[model samples]
Target: MLRDIDPILSPDLLHALRAMGHGDEIVIADANFPAEGLGPRCIRADGSSASDMLRAALSVLPLDTFVPDPAHSMAVVDDPDAIPEAVADFQRIIDDTADHPARIAPLERFAFYERAASAFAVIQTGERRLYGNIILKKGVIAP
Candidate 1:
């Protein structure tokens, strides 16, 4: 238990967040995500919802302001325009927690998987909702 830190953020997760540099990306993935096979390191957030994990991560990780879209979510198959309930929750959480105003850009299913595979790390959450996955780019803290 650290002071002011969300309990949901385990030690390993905190280490990953702290170790990431500006522009490095991390994925907060749903239960269905194949995090283990992804090239990057995987952290398990079992029993935690995607929204809960997102909120906890955003509490300390700053979103990259250099990029137009610092956050991303998987798009519903064949319906790029449709926002699933979990994706909507992700937007709300980002809106509430990010240092700057930002929205989660929708990524094609394969595109999203490719991005996740290249991320600095993947936090696999136990969220059962389809398409609850999200990716966040790390940003530098202003001096």
Candidate 2:
């Protein structure tokens, strides 16, 4: 066990977060997400909620400040304005963890899937909520 590290963060997830460079993105996906067929490497966070997993990841991974939007979540299908309960949970976690208040931009299903495929890695959580998927871009640590 490492000092001060959230036990929810598996070793593989920690490695991926550490290996990612500034602006590299990582997706914290729901169980329904097509993570397996996506191109990016996938890490399983089975039995964990998406919000819990997101908090664990954000504990160590800094969000990119260079971009106007460093956080993203999948928008409800056919209802872009709809905010799923899970997405709200994700936003709460992001707001609490980020250096500044962060807004989680909503993306259409296909766009979200495409972005996930191009992310540095995907952490598939066991969260059963629809539209629970969220993407976070890594940022450099201040010197």
Candidate 3:
């Protein structure tokens, strides 16, 4: 086991994160997401919940600051303004990882799928709850 890595980050997940350039996106998705048919690559944190997996990923990867909406979550159906409890959990996780609160964009279902399709990779989690998916953009570390 690597001393510094999150145990959930298998070699493939590390490779995907390493391959990503600044601003490339990754999604830590709910169990119900179609992770298999998505992304050029997929990694399974088979026993972990999406939010837990997301928290682990954030322990390593940095969020992109080049874009305004570096984080994204699915919007409540038919109520774009409503924040799901799962999304609120995501906000808190990001806020703690970042220095301040993250301004996450609530994407419509289809928009979220589009973003997922283009992501560098998708980390599919075991979370069974609805609206548990989250997207993160990769950021650079200053040299």
Candidate 4:
């Protein structure tokens, strides 16, 4: 086991994260998310909460500062303003980990799926919360 690495990060997830370059995006999806159908490389993190996986990912993954919003969550269907409990947890996780806490941009259901399709990879979690899916854009480590 690697010291300081979040144990929740499986070898596949770590490889995907390492393979991704700056500006590339990764999706952390809920159980309900149609991850396989979306077409990006998929990693199964079943039996784990999206929040847990998200935190683990944030531990190693740097957020894209070049973009105004590096974090994004799917908007509640028919109620874009309503934030899911999971999304709130995501916001807190991002705020705690990022050097500059970026707001979680809300995307409509279809739009979110469209974006996920182009992500470098999708980490599907067992989280049952509605709107638990979030996308994170990778950033470079400063020299």
Candidate 5:
């Protein structure tokens, strides 16, 4: 167990985060997310909640400042404006953890799936909440 690192972040997850370059994206998906079917490297964090996984990831991964929205979450079907509890938690985590003030924008259902499929990796969490999935773009660490 590495000091200062969240225990929930397994070795595989840490490797993926470290390997990602600026602009590369990673998905922290809910239990319902078809992580395996969507492709990309899938890392299972089945015992962790989406929020827990998000917080752990953000602790080390910097959000892309070049893009307006470095973080994104799946929108509720037919009610894109609605913020689910899990998504609210995500926003809170981002607000608290990000080096910059990053807000999580909502992505259309299919659009989110497409983005997740193209992500550098997907961390599938055991969060049971609907629409708990989030995508984070990696950013450069300033010298």
Candidate 6:
């Protein structure tokens, strides 16, 4: 038990977050996401929702402020304008955690998949919410 560390964050998750460099991305994905084949390394939180896992990650990981879009979520299929309820909750979670209203950019399914595959690692959560997948770029903690 480390001081102030969320128990939800396992050694693997903490290691991945610490090992990631500025601008390196990580994905917190839903159960439906193909995370096994998506990331070079994967951390599984089979019973947790993507938002829950993401909140836990944000508690420890800093979001890259250097980039215009440090956060991304999968867009509703066949409708770019369609925002899923899960995404709404995701935005709320991010807003509450990050305390910023930076818009969550919507990505096409294929683009999201490609991005996730290239991320440092993907955490697969058990979230049953549709379009719960989200990606975050790591940032520097200014001294």
Quote model 3's TM-score. 0.93
Candidate 5, residues 1-143, lDDT tens digits: the string is 99999999999999999999999999999999999999899999999999999999989999999999999999999999999999999998888888885888999999999999999999999999999999999999999
Poorest stretch of ten by lDDT in candidate 5:
94-103
Model 3, 9-34: lDDT tens per residue?
Answer: 88888888888998899999888999
30-129 in candidate 1: lDDT tens per residue? Answer: 9999999988999999989999999999999999999999999999999999999999999988888888859889999999999988999999999999
Q: Distance from true position, residue 114, model 4, in Å?
A: 0.3
How well is each residue in 1-143 modelled by candidate 2, as lDDT tens digits? 89999998889989999999999999999998899999899999988999999888888888888899999999888899999999999888888987655799999889999898999999999999988899999988899
Clashes of 4: 0
Q: Candidate 5's C-alpha lDDT?
A: 0.95
User: What is the TM-score of each predicted model, taking all chains together?
Assistant: 0.98, 0.97, 0.93, 0.97, 0.98, 0.94
Model 6 spans > 4 angstroms off: 99-101
RMSD to true structure for each model, in Å: 0.6, 0.8, 1.4, 0.8, 0.6, 1.3
Clashing pairs in 4: none
Model 2 lDDT at residue 61:
83
Which ranges of candidate 5 are over 4 A from the true structure?
none
Question: Which of candidates 1 and 5 is the stronger one according to lDDT?
Answer: 5
- Over the stretch 1-143, how does candidate 4's per-residue lDDT look in tens digits? 89999998999999999999999999999999999988899999997899999999999999999999899899888899999999999999988976667999999889988999999999999999888899999998999
Model 4 spans with C-alpha error above 4 angstroms: none
Residue 49, candidate 1: how far off, in angstroms? 0.5
Q: In what order do the candidates fall by lDDT, top score first? A: 5, 1, 4, 2, 6, 3
By TM-score, the better pick of 2 and 6 is: 2
| Model 1 alpha-carbon drift over 4 Å, by segment | none
Please give the lDDT score for candidate 3: 0.85
Span of ten consecutive residues with least summed lDDT in model 1? 92-101
- Give the TM-score ranking, best first: 5, 1, 4, 2, 6, 3
Please report, as a residue range, the 10-residue window in candidate 4 with the lowest summed lDDT: 93-102
